[model samples]
Target: MAPKPKKKSSKFSGGKGRLSRESKPVKWIESMAVDMIVTLKKISSEYYHELPNRPDAHEARLFYKNIPTRRNRYGDIPCLDKTRVALIDARDGNDYIHANWVTMPNARCRYIMTQAPLPETTADFWSMVWQENVSLIVCLTKIFEQGKMKTLEYWPTSCGKQFHQKHGHVHIRNVGVRNEPHFALTLLEAVNEKSMERRKIQHYLYLDWPDHRVPICTHNFLQVVRYVDEEIANYKGKEPMTIVVHCSAGVGRSGTLVALQSLVGSVNEGQVPQVCQVVSMVRKQRAMAVQGPEQYLFLYWALTVHITSCCQIPLEAKKDLLKRLVLMKNCSTKSACSLSPITTDQPDAATSSARQARNEDGGDRKRRPSNVKRKTPRGSVTVRKSKP
Candidate 1:
């Protein structure tokens, strides 16, 4: 039998031997977490190098047969059939698309990660959106990136314009469009003319991300995430909705966004978010959820920044806190003093206790005793309960 694994003493510190799934960031109250910024940085650096390589692409072999029809930017990476999205056909029945369902059971977030639709697959993409009842579409790539076609112009760019694909019998009409510095919003109505049913789909195109890397500035990126999250919550439905997210190849920037949303959503839900654990979970559902070490590191940096922002620590206080943290780290736990030796403006425990005692004695000298009755209103009674 395999020997039992050794347990880690600190979750923020990198672990020993093999990686553990349940390992996560330490849970601290909102106020206490500001002190953990140093620890967060340390763990992020360590964990960035510790992430496992992408598992062998066992599904790669299946892509060659569908190369003519599929539009994956990377030919070597194909969605696994087990998790790949399937479309029902009238005659052929159950065709596969280069999309996977990424579900985070704990945070209650689900996403369909797909490749940039080719001109041919654009119709099928809308068909999937219609069938799946997707509430939001998160497009991470532009129509052109690095002077190459990164993503097809799948949606109608102008309001009151209509696009139809005869092959998939999909009709998309743009009703409204809104553009912002961070993202563009398009209100779309998808019609399955065969059934004569219409569905409203919200298209969100994130403008700043690169083809294979994270955004240079995370602020706008996070704003895009918040927009998607708010739209998901605002959606009115009994069934949970799936947000369709795609980039060039569907694994690199796409995975990064999905993982970011998952971790950030988890943090918002009062959970200590674990980058590796969340990435691992996403990869289980969609292979290579976080494509490389850079993307992996970005996830940590983004989370750390997000958490620090939520703490609302002033710039000066942050520097002071960091200095104090350095002092706490430099001091020895086995020192003569039980508490930290770091000097601070706040009074020490002994000083605080003495001050409290003095205040109590002064109150005793000035106060009326409990035996002396206090006046009460005519119609109301007053009761003073003794302190427990």
Candidate 2:
């Protein structure tokens, strides 16, 4: 006789027969999460050092070879010419910007993953937004990090600022700017100088994400994702609009956020999430998405947190599993580090407005919570402790 299958060591696994109604969904999700994390960790460990070498599609190689592509901020990372988005010359102009259109099959989600806009490329960036009829722009990196300029201030800070470009000219006005605990919302109005026509766009600048790193708590990030999806569902036009997302390189942080969003989307649809599959699909569309193992691991944590929050798992039970299933993984490495415990709270409007004003006046300094202080070096998992 064949040997009996080994008992699955999971929180939900208890000499399985039939599970209780409440326990069934939570147990299924928990088991699925464990398997997903193991697979991701294995994949990350094997490919942590470098991306797998794969030949580019023929047309993409042609663009890489023949087309005049702009030099990326980092010489090492280049946008594959084949997947790069080209300007609608007949409608916009001849200049092409470095942005790619990525769509996920299961999630039915689409994104324009582009690099942080250079000063010269800012106009082209706006041009692409206008031509593509993009309704949302998700900025994942800070404009400046450690006194180095990471991304340009592409949008008009104040209302009625005329932004001029070689191919097109438009007046960009900031209609409203509201800052929440984790992210900022800026409503923009763009007026075409030639036709005097106008359009509205929403910009979400997520502040919690550190440069070249992942957030300690995924709660706020999930809130932002939910907020964006809810807003996208309200689009009035017939053609679905694309959401533009970017970080400094458009691969690391940007990729992580997109991958997490895709996984969460699948889970919300009552399907088990496959983290590695989502990451691989995204990488195929862009390149080097979810850049490192730490980031890859982060997607799992964010998804787990989401499941617990949605499933109404008891705080003690959630905490126990978090300690056992999530924190058990060793995250410390040269490029990655461990984070402190997570805190989850509902978003407050008044607090958001106050934070916005403070941010406007003092910039990043005011954004740091006063009761907490960073206990780790840069590029590591920063731990924040409350003041005694």
Q: Give the candidate number with the greatest lDDT.
A: 2
**lDDT value for candidate 1?**
0.58
Off by over 4 Å in 1: 1-52, 57-61, 68-71, 90-94, 162-167, 312-315, 319-388
Return the top candidate by TM-score.
2
C-alpha root-mean-square deviation, candidate 2: 12.1
TM-scores for the candidates: 0.68, 0.72
Q: Point out the worst 10-residue segment of candidate 2 by lDDT.
A: 7-16
Q: Candidate 2 overall Cα lDDT vs. reference?
A: 0.60
lDDT of 1 at 40: 49
lDDT (10s digit) by residue, model 2, range 309-366: 5555456776666556544234512223223333334433323433443355363212
TM-score of 1: 0.68
Q: Give the per-residue lDDT digits (tens) of candidate 1, residues 143-261.
A: 88789998888887565433432337667765445554545665566777789887766677777776556675655565665555544443445556678999888888888888887
Clashes in predicted model 1? 0
List the pairs of residues colliding in candidate 1: none
